[model samples]
Target: MPSSFSSQMLSSGGLGLAAGLSLIVAIGVQNAFVLRQGIRQEHVGAVVAVCAVSDAVLITAGIAGLGAVVEQADGVLRWLTWFGAAFLIGYGLLAVRRALRPSAGLEAERAATTTSVAAAVSTALALTWLNPHVYLDTVVLLGSIGNGEGPSGRWWFAGGAVLASLLWFTILGYGARLLAGFMSRPSSWRILDGLVALVMLTLGVLLLVRG
Candidate 1:
């Protein structure tokens, strides 16, 4: 009986990890921001830390049943939707400006536009916190699914999800340097920034239209 229970818990944890990765592995605004910071090699550690820790908190909240609370908070969601849309639009404009500017090599541009650590951290926080989808995925969806694991199994499930977040951010932030050779050209930066702008703008507009 004990062994059977253990097998079920392991299965639950594996499912949690898979579900978390499925939701998170997409190329969204937060991922784009993290990739850019990683390429720039500016405060990458801090950015990764922020993202991982935020995920941990949210996942834990979900596992602890805060998801139900969030679901009932219509006013909070509305406020976040409006605020997030505004923030994304502003950030998207910056990306557009970067894309339009005369580009330099990635390293040269990094040197020229070296952002303060605090500023980078602030941007990371904003990117992680402002998006309503983050709440929905981490708190509502993940939470509801985790709660289905029953009390003891839910913690293991949350652990698996948190581990996924940590592994993903660490690999993305640190391993981004591997693409330095390809992203060395000035034109590469322009293309990347343009894509980032499009993503941010589209998400922002969608939030406004849908919300």
Candidate 2:
């Protein structure tokens, strides 16, 4: 009995770690925004913390059987995808507009001053919650994998997954910020914003068009 228990525990731990790592390893739009903000070295700490904490909350919710509820809701995924796509496209358009408009140094300073922690937190939450992929990855996929384990194993799996998300967002936000100096130029911002626009438009169109 002891041996069987030990074996089960080990298996569960392995499974949890695998599930956590697999989902968090992929780069998505949220990560891209975090990276961009980080590289700009603007609100580095706030950005990383908000992103990590938001992810932790979502992962925990998924583990708490939230996945089942989400699964039962008809058209939940489709609606989420649409909302996410719209936000992305709208945000990208704003970025493109900013890139096109060259602000005076005084106006730029005032703009920077207005970027508060609350705004950062709100943005992070929006980015995290708007994405339907988060639901599929955390709630459905991770939750399914975790459900296979025993009670203790479920916690372990959740821990691993949360750890993965926290680590990735934290690192991406801080590490990318180091590049802010290089990305500070108006031309650089323009190019970066343009790419962001393209990505948002593509993702939005794809989601809306998807049957």
Candidate 3:
């Protein structure tokens, strides 16, 4: 019986990890922002830490049943949706401006435009928290799925999900440096910033229209 239970726990954990990765590995505003920071080699550690920790907190909250509480508060979700949309749109506009006026080439030029640590951290926090979809994915979707594992398996599932987040953010933050060669070109930065702008704008518009 113990062996059988262990198998079940393992299965639950695997499912949780897979689900978490599927949700998180998507190309979204948050990922784009992180990738940009990584390419710039700015406070990469701080950015990754914030993202991983935020995911852990959100996933834990989902597992702990805070998702239900959030669901009950429709007003909160509504407010978040509107606020997030505005933030995305504004950020997208900034990206558009950057793309229109491409900066100088490579790390030296990019470094000149590097933001302060506090600003970078603040942007990371905003990107993580302002998006309503984040709550829906981490809290409502993952939470409900984790809860399905029952009492004994739920925490194990959450652990797997948290692990997935840690792995993804770490890779994204650090692995981005590998692409620095390509990103060093002015044209490359323009393309990347342009895409970021489009993604942010689309997400913002979708939120407003859907809401």
- In candidate 2, position 168 carries an lDDT of 81
Colliding pairs, model 3 = none
Candidate 1 lDDT, 1-211, residue by residue in tens: 9997888779888988998899889989889998998888789999999999999999999889899999999999999999999999999999999998886698788888899999999998998899999999999999999889987888888988998888888889989888788889999889989999999999999999988
lDDT of 1: 0.90
Q: Per-residue lDDT of 89-155 in model 2, one digit per residue for the tens?
A: 7776776686577644333523653567787667777877887777878887888777767676777
Which is the better candidate, 1 or 2, if ranked by TM-score?
1
TM-score of each prediction: 0.96, 0.81, 0.96
Question: Model 2: which residue pairs collide?
Answer: 38-177, 39-176, 39-177
Full ranking by TM-score:
1, 3, 2
Looking at candidate 3, the ten consecutive residues that score lowest on lDDT are 102-111
C-alpha displacement of 129 in model 3, angstroms?
A: 0.8
**Candidate 1 displacement at residue 140 in angstroms:** 0.2
